[model samples]
Target: QPVTEEPSALAPPAAKPKSAVFYRHLRLDFPAIVRGEGSYLILDDGRRILDASGGAAVACIGHSDARVGEAIMSQIKSASYCATLLYTSTVCEQLCRLLVDSTNGQMARAYIVCSGSEAMEASLKLARQYFLEKTQPEPQRTHFIARHQSYHGNTLGALAVGGHKSRRLPYEPILSTNVSHVSPCYAYRGKKAGESDAEYVVRLADELDAEFQRVGPEKVCAFVAEPVVGGALGAVPSVPGYFKAIQAVCRKYGALFICDEVMCGMGRTGSLHAWQQEEGVFPDIQTYGKCLGGGYQPIAGILASHEIIDTISKGSGAFVTGHTYQGHPVSCAAALAVQHIVAEENLLANVSELGPYLGELLTKRLGDHPYVGDIRGRGFFWGIELVEDKATARPFPPKANVAMEIIDLGLKGADYSVALYPGSGTADGVSGDHVILAPMFNASRAEIETIAD
Candidate 1:
């Protein structure tokens, strides 16, 4: 009998490279990413594309970090798996503690989970559960009031709470009808010619107030919003006192305020939490992700305030939420390590110091461009809204795919090797275009200049 030889583990698999992967764009052939180093993505063809947007603003700490790798390895070698149903690992607890501490007691408890969508789903359920644990159990308070042009997540529950028309169109019939939309506090396009920030905020607040009244305030569970609107609105931050005014409406209606900071929080907006910069207003419940783990692992979690935690504690002594990998050791360890690096190196301070320069450079370079209509953001996250006519702020039609074209141009050749985050529907629900530039928090002045150039 002849001896049989097996395929070497080092060799590539026999199947077609792209066959097994279900990409976001099924019709397009995707580039193969071999590796990442610092703020650049290395392609299999030896191209080094600068990662300016950090893959939808996820990688805040950068691509390659030996510290995070070692921490993940150490956890894997010691104890990689632990069922949160039966037990909790120290790594998970530590990450939770760090998260809670980062909030400075404004948010009391942290429930660890996997992705931003998962975190948003958990938040929705938790909001409902909080109402149930009330003295009278206001179960009728199941409706959510969210802003228009917001993207919470793609999950069914999260989708229902978001108001992005294009994204919700396919599932509108199937999605829950309990959620309603109010106008977002968008200053650039929504504000009047002579409107001050205060007047704009008041007008938006009135819109929210009217929505709550129209929906029957007592029947609403919570008013959900992103402190700095991400994705759907292209990194648009609310005008001063906007959050406070909206939060007041929620309070007046005896409803909870759930802030979805999945994309804008975790120091992406120069502060660990975006709400911290919003007139000292703290949310009842906050969902966080993206830069939370700095793209080191699949980890996201919710931070519930003391008021919410106490309510559930007093009523049934239980909050109904569970996930099998809720507190996975390896994921927690990786996140913890990334956060530790963030703190030890003071990356948040770096964001604060260098963020203004990024904005200035973007304005200096792209401000007067024919296609640039608006440039707005805070911290290291900035968005450039592209338009066909800057004077009229007329967005190129969605059919043109202007946002994607800019991204394509940025990634074209070694001469223009840069990656940007593309988004649509910035002007309205269907025809706007914008691209975001969210570099690593630790990016130097030179790199920031390069990105701007």
Candidate 2:
């Protein structure tokens, strides 16, 4: 018999990539991701991990799409960055045009911004500017009523308007003083014990209305909310008629309904915009990000309808805002390419197709598990609530580190390398935890299975 060649142990196993900085959290030995293809990250150690959360649901069309790359290169060849004040590039204008057209030409125009936070800030400022343009300069129109357990951004103003206590806790001292939060329409934990869905929605709407009244309706400029609550409370969507009711109340108070679809918009909710499916409700101001550029570039925007734009354009003749990178040439080109692919390739239909399938798989696998409590979401975005006890709906103590454990398990398990984002204090504002799975927009059925498993 031929002697088997002894395995050479010359090469020691490679070291795992480490996080750049660690303050007090766990010492993480993160993998060095060298490349991304479709819906997977290729680590330096030759391991392939399915990107489940996409670094917080930003990778919509998946990695390394040539169209987006070419577009970026094209813009780079032309000009990488241009001052928004002095010039408006074709790429930015076209990106806006595509967005407005996709909204069925209902939207007036897009205010390009660098991040979701910037867009939210623009939304806030634009609402104020709109009032000034309309000659209804109510100084009292300064308060913002947003939903609890929702995330806007990490920036100061967005964080202030956000209701995520954990994100806001550290900066509470310096955050804005003009914002107040109301209960989110999170039915799994927020809906009343015996109330019908409609009744629960009505009551929540009433609660929001009451908050506005308490703040003085004339003083409030906008009511902000993610059509689907994001990482702060998992992918929790409002019950049917909830948005309609909220919209009605906003109209009643003459406040701008600012829908922050940052996490849920741009086809994440199986529609181009989440509000499009909600009957009888269209936001006067809407912010979008993440999937807007399909993760091809850092692009976010605020959409103003004809009413707001006409008011601003005629009254002020200029929006009171500016950003050096507001409409960068390369970013806009990448975004334009991404949006074009999303439409030309019909990826939104894919989102609608795979979103429910992923939901079903998550429910079937974890719904009956003792640790799993609720499975809720829409489109490709979904969330899983973990409970220590289903009967009591009691959450694992924050010290237990439930969601982080699952994430570690996922990384360890060869079946998948999907990420699990942990949300603390999801219930009420001080308790409850969840995991969100927002796969790529173009993920196939098999990729979805790998992610779910």
Top model by TM-score, which number?
Answer: 1
Residue 277 displacement (Å), model 1: 0.7
Query: Runs in model 2 with CA error above 4 Å?
Result: 1-26, 136-138, 426-431
C-alpha TM-scores of all predictions = 0.95, 0.93
Candidate 1 local distance difference test against the native: 0.86
What tens digits encode model 2's per-residue C-alpha lDDT throughout 1-453?
111112232222455345676654666566566668887776665656677887777888888888789889989998888888889988888888888887776689988887999999899889878876675544557788988767888889889999877778899999989999888887878776898999998899899889987999888888999888888888988899999999999999999999999989998989999999899888998999998887778889899989988876777689988988898888889888888888899999999988999999988888899888899999988889888888878888877778888877876665556665666654342447788888888889988887776
Candidate 1, 1-453: lDDT as tens digits: 111113242233455366557767787876677678888887654557888989989998889788899999999999999988788899888989988998877988899889989999999998898887783633788889998888999999999999888788889899999999988887878899998999998999899889888999888999999998888878889888999998898899999999999999999999999999998698999999889788989988899989998988888887788888887899999999988888889999999999989999999988999999999999988989988888888888877888998899888744658899999753353336889989998898988988888
**Stretches of candidate 1 exceeding 4 Å from the true structure:** 1-18, 135-138, 426-431
lDDT of 2 at 371: 81
Candidate 2 local accuracy as lDDT?
0.83
